[model samples]
Target: MFPRTLLLLLSLILFKTTHAQLHLDYYRNSCPDVESIVRSAVQEKFQQTFVTAPATLRLFFHDCLVRGCDASVLLASRNNRAEKDNPENLSLAGDGFDTVIKAKAAVDNVQECRNKVSCADILVMATRDVIALTGGPSYAVELGRLDGRVSTKASVRHQIPHPDFKLEKLEAMFATHGLTLVDLIALSGAHTIGFSHCSRFSKRLYNFKSKTRIDPTLNPAYARELRGMCPEEVDSRIAISMDQTTPQTFDNVYYKNLERGRGLFTSDQTLFTHKRSRDIVRLFAFNSTAFEIAFVDAITKLGRIGVKTGNQGEIRGDCTIVN
Candidate 1:
């Protein structure tokens, strides 16, 4: 018998899985090699550049956060503004967009699967590949998501949380998408493999608030190191690893850094200070497997947010524009 709380959590996940049209073998008959095809495409790009894995992973998070995992983030609007044009999303690496486009083309080349698979599904698989390739736990990605037809600049600004969000605001944002406090902490572990522009977190390095010149929670030495790398508004565009320990790997060291006031973003550091989420942050810092398990669970749930299904969206021949 399960504990009452455990049973309730299981029920919620079961309910979400059923309604989201998520399943393992959704493309078994239609496109049996879909996952492999995407894996190859992502791998090819990754070999050429180290950024591919992080870029692809970030693309998935941005896509899911704004409009579910519908690949709307890949849309290219002819007009002046679109989701990709939003200042929040403007930093999305072009290599990530190119990787998805290349993967979609690979899928289309298969005679049995030509124009049959959704770009949304390909993005999910590519994200899984990114995790697997970067020494992280691999999990089966659910399929059957339809391609969303809509993408707008307004949604990106309204939906995505910035790096500076406080714990309470972060919690509310995640809650709106059916995620919990634990999920927020786990998903943040994705930072282990990515880089952030100094502009995103420079306030913590200098002039944080009236209380202190810099964020008091940040380690003084570490803040000095970041200052040398970023140097005020002059070099704000320079990128720095989120995980100073192992920049290329996806691991729990990000949480460990938070324990020592080395978290790069205000949002990252607050997980350690806020009473409600502090314990959760410590748990992941001490146990890598626990963090990986929670992350897989959180990402699985995240992929289902606001998904388009049934006859709601189309499978575009080219992922950049809706058919």
Candidate 2:
């Protein structure tokens, strides 16, 4: 058996090897204009609709949460059972996929960048643009991730946090990704700009359990409004903004809403009800700058989770297919 000191050195060497290939300037020589090319393409899609911004942002988070930020969510398996096909991801908007496809096409059009840039990197860039264009901080995203080759539907099962998850469950889920309670609260703020299908949150408005009663934790007036929008046993396809106030903007209003019992998801409201996380929620509710800074830091760390670097994965020529 190897000595303890030798084992420690070996572990460090392995970690370094896995992460060594990912650098901010990985494309400096091969695709000098990759960012500009992707940005322009995503902007064109942004002009098409308001949904694109949140959709793209959700795509990035889902991509990272399930199988790391390797663009596996974009894959189209021949079996029609890729990660995106899972029921949990069915709510993910198509506009997000369109934005990334357009951006990848733009990259391919560039002379030196054709088939050189990874879809994973394009995803990171588009996510950054989504946040910036939505009036959030425009922080730098580190690049050089490789496209994942596997995207099984089974892989997506239980990977993302459910809307009904409680505070403890949410904390445990984020902890799996090396995220903290603060990260969970800050990242949940992404709900500020997105829409959710009635089916996703109807339980809180209708009979939460076997009893015919609305969730008491939810604001009664808001529950009535949601009930109108999503009548019991009606069309589940009806949608509602996760944040009713300034739904299109990306800000601390989500935290403020949580304080008012207007949080759309059970997991969201639990942050305020749970003693451990309530103080942090109050802090962000009153301080947009603090929320912004924490969000930027958390998302940056999230983007790095389980990232594939070096020869572990390939730079796929197409975002939808392994190559």
Candidate number of the best TM-score: 1
Candidate 2 residue-wise lDDT, 1-323, digit = tens: 22442343344335432234467777999999898898899889999998999999999999999999999999997878999999988889999999999999999998899989989889889988988888999876788888898899999988899989999999998999988777788899999998999988888877676365788899988998999889988999988999999898999999999999999989889999998888778888877877787787678778887788767789888899998
- Reference-based TM-score, model 1: 0.94
Provide TM-scores for the models. 0.94, 0.92
lDDT of each: 0.87, 0.86
TM-score result, candidate 2: 0.92
For model 2, the superposed segments whose C-alpha errors exceed 4 Å read 1-21, 210-212
Q: Count the backbone clashes (under 3 Å) in each candidate.
A: 0, 0
How many times do residue backbones clash in model 1? 0
State the lDDT at 209 in candidate 1. Answer: 80
Cα RMSD to native, each candidate? 2.7, 7.1
Could you tell me which 10 consecutive residues in candidate 1 have the lowest summed lDDT?
A: 1-10
Instruction: Tell me the lDDT of model 1 at 234.
Output: 70
Candidate 1 lDDT, 131-224, residue by residue in tens: 9999999998888889999999888876887888999999999999999888899999999999999889988877678565788989988988
